[model samples]
Target: MEQQRAAHSTEAVVGMVAQTFLRDRHQFVGELSQLMRTQLPVLDRDERLRELMEAGTTDNLMEILQFLQNEAGEDDVRAPERALAYARILAQRDVPAAALIRAYRVGQAGFLDTGMRYAIEFGGGGPVTTSAIVHIVNRTSVYIDRVCEQVGVAYEDERDRWSGNRSGLQRQWVTRLLDGTVTDTDAAEQYLRYPLSRGHLGIRAWTGPQLDPATAATVFDQLRTALTTVFGRAHATLVVPVDDHEIRMWLAWPAGTAVDSGAIARALTARGVPVRVAIGGYGTGLAGFRRTAAQAGRVRRLALLGGDHGARVLAHADVAAVALLAGDIEALREFVADQLGELAVDNERNLWLRETLRVFLAVNRSYAAAATRLAVHRNTVQYRVRQALDMIGPHADVPGGDLYPRLALQATELLGTAVLRPEPDRN
Candidate 1:
C-alpha cells in the first residue's frame, strides 16, 4: 500500500488515480499539471507531502503543483477520483464530509461490500451536499440541489439493480456478463485510460426472425457483433433469448451512444435483417435502462404488429402498442385458457383464468403466481398448463419464445380488452 502510495509520485500513477474521479483524463491531467506548475511556488512541500513532491518523484509533480496553485485549486475542479478516494478514507474513518464517490472500477465492484452506490454519474463523482461546508456553502447548496435531482434517479437505479440481484437478476456468466465496451476492451479502467465507449450510452437490441430459430440465433450473433461494432464493444449479457428461435433477442446498454435510428436502419438493411431499433429513451442508470429496454421490446412488438412491411425491428417510438403485436398472447392465453382457463367451470372461472393470464403477463409469464391466483394446487396448475399446451398443438412452440404465449394473450386481449391486465413497468 505504501509503495502504491509512493507510486503516486509518478504522473502516470497520479493520473490513473485522478481518473477515478474526473472525466477527460488527458485533458484533466493537462490542466491539473498546469495548476500544480503555476501554483507550485516551490517543488518541496511540508515533510509529509514532500515525499510525494520530490523533484525525482515524478516528471511532472512540480509542473502539476504549478497547475494546482496557478489555477487556485480550480485545477482539481473535476478531480472526483482523487476527491472521492480522499473522501473514502475520510468517510471510512467517519469524517462525514460532503463528497462524491467516483464511478465503479472496471471490474472492481465486488470489493464494494455495501453495494450502496450513490448514483450512476457519467462524470466521476462530487461532494454529497446537504447543509454543510463553511465556505461556498450557498453555491455548494445550489449545486447540491441540482445534483440531488440526478441523485434520486441514480440512487433508484442502483437500488433496482440491488433488487435484481436478490429476486430477479440473470445468471452471472450468461445474464449479467459485461464484455467490456468495444472502445474500451483494450483499455484498462485500472490504468486510467477512458472506458472508450459510445459515450456509455446506447441500447442492446433483441434481433432476428420469428420463423427461423437458426436464422434468429445467427442473427443474434450477427447483431451482437454488429451492434458492438456500431456502439463499440458494450456489455451484451443482459440480453436473454426471447424464444426457442435464436432470431429474437434483448439487450441493455448505458445511455448516450451514436447508433441512431437511421444508422441502425441502414445497417440492418445492409445486413439483410432489416431492423427496427428501439431507442430506449434517455433515463438515468441501469433501472432506467431496463425500463427503457422493455419499452423498446414492446415497441419492436408493436412495429412487427403494425404490419409494417419488410423486415421489422423496433426502437423506442413504437411503445404505444408493444403488447398487441410481439407474439401469441392468444396462444399463451389459449394455452392458459385451455390448461388453466378451462379450469373455470363457469363464466366466473373463465374470468378467473383471464385474470390469471393477465397476472402471468404482468409478471412476465411467471408460472408460480399464475397457479396461486387460480386457487389450485401447483401440480394441478402444471397439469392444466400442460393440457393447454397439448390443446394449442405444435404452433404453440413457435420459435422466438415470447410469441406463442404473447400472441395467445394478444388474441385474447384483443377479443377481451376490458378483461386484461396492464403490463407493469417492471421498473
Candidate 2:
C-alpha cells in the first residue's frame, strides 16, 4: 500500500512523509508534532497522521476539511490537485483519516469564529482572553466569506466590522476566486493549510429534518457568517454534530462584550432554518473557548427546560453559580436551607413562605395576580407574602411593604441559583 509511483517530489511531499512518520508526543516529540504539521496538523487514516495529530485531537480539523471539500465543488482548478493539497494539509498536520474526512465537510458551514478565554479548570486567556479567541474565530470567518464572495455566491457581510487583518494569501484567494484569474486546474488544486494547525474551532448546525452529509457540510461553512454577524472579528472553530441534531461551536468575547444569547438565537431563528447555536461562554484562549462552547450547551439545555426551543447563547457568569447546583430541585432547596436557613425560622420565613415568594416572583409583583396564578385565595397570598417580608426585614413592610419581600426574594433566591448545573442527575 505504501507503493510510490508518481509521488509528488517537492516540499509538500517531504512534509507529508515527515508527518506520516512521526507519532504522538509521548512516543516522540511534542515540538516536532507542532512543527511537522506547520501548526494546522495532518488528518488521515495513516497511523502517522494520528500520532502527529494527537496534540490538537479535539481541534476542528474536520470542519476545515468540509470547507475545502465544498470549495472544491466549484473551484476553477477543477483538478484533483486541490483535494490533494487539502489532503496534504491534513497529512502535513498529522490529522487522522477519520478526522480529515470530517474536516472536509466543514466547507458546508456558514462560517466559524474563534474566541479567547482564561480559566483554570477549562483553558484561560488572561486579560485579553476574549479578544484572542474572537480574533481567531472571526478571522477564519472572513477568510471563508471572501472565498464565497469570490466564487460569485451569496455571502452575508459581518454585522460587526471586525476582520482583524487579512493575510496576503487569503486576500489573493479572494481576488483569484472573484476575478477568475487563477487557472482552472490551479484553482481546483488550491486548498492550502486547511488541516494545517489545530488553533481554530468550528460552529456548525443543520436544517433538514433528516440530515445528510451534504446538508450538514453546507451548514457548517455558513456558521462563520452567522458568528461574524454577532461576534465580529472573533475567530471560531466550528463543527456541526453528526446529522442535523445540533450546532456545536467554540469562540470567545472580550471582557465587556456583554454577549446577548437571546439576540444571537433570534438571528439564527430568523433564517427560518432549524438552526441551533451553542455560543461559547465568554473566556480567554483556546481551552477557555472550549469551555465556553461547553457552557453554551449547558445553557442551551437549560433554555430547553425553560421552553426556549432553538438556538441560544450560554453565558458563563450568569450560569456559573446556578450550574454548580448540579441541576437538582431538591439539591437547590437543600442549598437554600444551608445558606439562608434563618429565612425559614418564622412562619413568614419557612419553606412554605419561601415557596409562596417564589410563586409570587414567578408571577411578578402582583399579589392578587400571584394568588390567582397559584390558584389560592388573595388573602392567603397576602399573608404568606407578609410573612416573607417579616423574614426580609421586621420593619421593611411597615413603610415599604413593597421593598420588604423584594429584598427577601433576592436573599432567598441566592440558594435557587445553583439548580442550573447539567451534570448527570443524582436525584
Candidate 3:
C-alpha cells in the first residue's frame, strides 16, 4: 500500500509538470522549432516547410503532454497527423530519412531536458524527485519511440511512392542540377537524357487549383507538346510536374536557334489550355540552364504577386527591370508614389495619362510614335502627356530626363493598382 501510494504521488508530480509545460506551450514550441530549423537546415528551406515544422512541433508537444496527464498504455500512443504530414513533406522534398530521424531525436532530448527541470522543481530534489524523473523518462521515451516509428513508416512510404515514378526521377535530377550538386555536365546530360551544352530556355506554367486532376494533367501535357513544337521538332524537351497545378520545363535547342514567344503564346491559345506562363531568357550550357530556371522562377513570383493583368505570358527579359524593383514592394510603391504623385492614382483618367506618358517616354518622347502605339491622334497623345507631366510636377522634367518617371511608369504598367493610390469606393 505504501509503494502504491508512492507510485500515485510520482504520477501526480509528472502530471503537474506536464500541465505547467502545456500552459507554456507556445514558448516551448518556438524553442523546439528554432532548434529544429537550426540543427536541420533542410526544414528551413521555405515558408511552407517552416510552417509545417512548427505545426508538427505543436501537435507532438500536445500529444506528449496529454500522454503524461493520462495513464495511457504505450501501444495506445500514435504520431500526430501534422507530424506525419511533415515527415511526408520531408520525404517528398528529398530530405534524407536520417535527417527526419535526427529531428525526432533532437526534439526528444530537448523535451526530456525540459521535463527533468520541471520534475526537479516539483519534487524538490529528493526520492520523490528521482521517482518523478524516472517516470517521466520512461513514458517520454516510449512516446518518442512509438511516434518515431510511425513517422518513419510514413516517411519511407512517401519516399517510395514519390520516387517510384518518372516525374520523381526527373525532379531529383532537376533539383540536383539547380542546386549545383552535379558538376559534370556529361554525367548530368546522360542521366537527364538531354544535352547540357546546348542552348536552354526554362519555362514555368501553372493553372488555378480549381482544375481537377485529370484536367490539370491534360493541360500540362498539352503545354509540353505545344512548347516542344514551338522550340523545334528536333530539340529535346524536359517537363516536370511541380505539383497538381504547376510544372517546370526546360527546352534545349542547338545554338543560334530563334525562339518566338508570340508563336508559343498563340499555340497555347489555340489549344485553349487556360494556363499562365513565365519564360526565362535563352542561355547556353550548364550556366544557362541554372540561370534561365532562376529567371523564370523570379518572373513567376512577380506574375503571381501582380495577379492577372491580361498578361498570359511574362518573359524575364521584358520584366527584368520591374522584377528587380519589385523585390521590395513597399519601397517600390513609395518610389512610384514619390515620382508620379497624383499620376499614381488608380482611376480611369490617371491610368490613361500614365499609359500615354509611358508610351511617349518609351518611344523616345516622339509624339507621332506614341500616338501610333496608343492608337490615338498625335494631338490627344500630346495633350495627355502634357497633363500627365503637369500632374507629375517638375520631377517628370527632372534635369537628367525621364529616367525616374520611366521606371515608375513601367512599375505602374506591370503592377497596375498595386503601387497606385486606391480609387475611392463609389458606395
Worst 10-residue lDDT window, candidate 1? 111-120
RMSD of 2: 21.1
Clashes of each: 69, 99, 0
State each model's CA lDDT, in order: 0.38, 0.41, 0.83
TM-score, model 1 to reference: 0.27
* The 10-residue segment with the lowest total lDDT in model 2: 153-162
For candidate 3, write residues 224-247 as lDDT tens digits: 888777765747877887755678
Sort the candidates on lDDT, descending order.
3, 2, 1
lDDT of 1 by residue, 1-427 (tens): 3323323122333233233324343443344433443444232121212222222123232223233223234323232222222222222222222212221121112111111121112112333211111122232333333333343344444345433542123222223323322233333222322232222332434433223445655666666666665656655433443222222233444665544565666667678763345455544343443355555545544443334342344445433343433355444343534433333222443444444544555555557877776676667655555554443445543344535455444434333432233443558
Q: What's the lDDT for residue 124 in model 2?
A: 29
Q: 1 or 2, which is superior by TM-score?
A: 2
Find the candidate with the highest lDDT and give its number: 3
Better of 1 and 2 by lDDT: 2
| Shift of residue 426 alpha carbon in model 3, Å | 10
lDDT per residue, candidate 2, 1-427, as tens digits?
3313223322223223223323221333343333344533333322223332443322223223233223332333221322333333343222344444343224223122111111111222233333333433543454444433322211111101112223323434433432446555244224432221223322323343345545655666555566668767653343323212344554433455656656666666675444554443445533443445556545544434333332244444544445444355466555444433355443332656777776776565579888888788989999987766555555434443434344334433433332222223558
